[model samples]
Target: METTEADGSLREAAGKVQQAAGDLLGDAGVQVSGKARELRAKAQQLYADLASVARESTLERPLTALAIAAGAGFILGLLRAASRQNRD
Candidate 1:
């Protein structure tokens, strides 16, 4: 997790530099790629952090986590059904 955090931050910072350079050179492709890289790094960091938090929370309160998961699943099912009806 520590390594992931450090790597993600570094990748994101590198992407910023790349994006700025691309802007100076007027290269749209480079800018777009750099932005994508930055977003990927940000997502990875978010996932890692969220996974840690969820693990700890589940360990501390298993029943609460289970209930939340069930509720989320139910809501998703309802949303999917509504979307299908709209399509029909």
Candidate 2:
């Protein structure tokens, strides 16, 4: 998670640099790509934060966490089965 945060920060900074350079050069594609990269970094950071929170919550309330996990697994299985049916 620490490594993920570091990588996300680096990517976000790089994206800002790329975005600025693209804007200065009037390259729309580069600007869009840079924006996408920045968003990806932000999403990664958000995911890590959520995971950390979830981890703490699980530690504090193991039973509730287990129930939630089971529910999520069930939902995912349903979705997968539906997806496979559609494919077939």
Candidate 3:
């Protein structure tokens, strides 16, 4: 009886080792972390590019700023209308 119990424990331990190894091989967390790091690098590069472009392009007029503000407001209003339509 004791020998059988010991063998069962060994089998359980072996199963645990295999499970751990399998988990290590196909880990979603590791994949997601790698993807997140890649995305962060891309975003940083894109932000730097945007900053350089901003430094180069001059929208140096009061009318240009007003037009930009009006366009943004119109886009936002359109988004709100779309959402309202979706709910209905």
Candidate 4:
């Protein structure tokens, strides 16, 4: 009877330990998920900041730069056309 009692007590202790381990793992998973979300949000904010700066800063003003590029391309095309004709 004493041996059986000892075995039962051991089994109960093991069950309690398993439950505690499961709880700890669940809490750790929640913490990791929360941290991942926080990092992702921060990354998104950084991307937005960079994009806004690129779009609005004088060095990268989109429409003016685009017009300059188009004008240069058109001039190059005109030069190419003049250079390609046969003189004879």
Candidate 5:
């Protein structure tokens, strides 16, 4: 497994244990904190998975990757400009 996947798994396991402890002790704060940690770990794992896929795709098709990146950048720039106009 990748380092990020391993770390995320460990973090998720810790969160589960914390959540169970909170449930046994009836501590809402601990329960909420554990739940948040679990969610963050899941998100981290998902990001790692997506990054791996993106890396592979980029390697397999560099031109396609460049095009997609350019398109995404253009869209982000437009969104930023729109946000600035709204703020002004």
Candidate 6:
């Protein structure tokens, strides 16, 4: 998790540098690529944060976590079944 956070930070920093270079060179492609990279890094960081929270929650109340997981799985199964029915 720490490694992931560090990597995300590095990626964000690199992206900012890329964006700045693009701006200086007047290149639309580089700018777009850099923006995408920055967004991805942010998303990664967000996921890591969420995962850490979830981990702590699970440790605090494991049965609740299990129930939630089961409910989510059941809902996903139902959704998949409905999609298949529609296709058929």
Tell me the whole-model lDDT of each prediction, alpha carbons only: 0.91, 0.92, 0.61, 0.61, 0.95, 0.92
Position 7, candidate 4: lDDT = 52
Q: Which of the two, 2 or 5, has more lDDT?
A: 5
TM-score of 1: 0.67
The predictions' CA RMSDs to the true structure, in order, are 3.4, 3.5, 19.2, 22.6, 2.7, 2.2
| lDDT, model 4 | 0.61
Model 2 Cα lDDT, one tens digit per residue, 1-88: 5888889899999899889989999999999989999999999899888888998999999999999999999999999999999999
Q: Considering every candidate listed, which one attains the maximal lDDT?
A: 5
Please give, for residues 1-88, the per-residue lDDT of candidate 3 as tens digits: 2443445445545545555555678976655555554455455556666665654553556577578789999999999999999999
Off by over 4 Å in 2: 73-88
Worst 10 residues of 1 by lDDT: 1-10
Indicate which candidate wins on TM-score: 6
Return whichever of 5 and 6 wins on lDDT. 5
The residue-level lDDT of candidate 5 at 86 comes to 100
TM-score for every candidate vs. truth? 0.67, 0.76, 0.38, 0.39, 0.81, 0.82
Clashes of 3: 0
lDDT of 6 by residue, 8-75 (tens): 99999889889888999999999999999998999888888888899999999999999999999999
Candidate 1 clashes between residue pairs 3 or more apart in a chain or in different chains: none
Q: Tens-digit lDDT track for model 5 on 9-54?
A: 9999999988988999999999999999998999999999999999
**Is candidate 3 or 4 superior in TM-score?**
4
* Candidate 5 runs further than 4 Å off: 74-88
Which window of ten consecutive residues has the lowest lDDT sum in model 4?
1-10
Candidate 1 local lDDT, 1-88, one digit each (tens): 5788888899999889888889999999989988988998999899889888998999999999999999999999999999999999
* TM-score-better candidate, 1 vs 3: 1
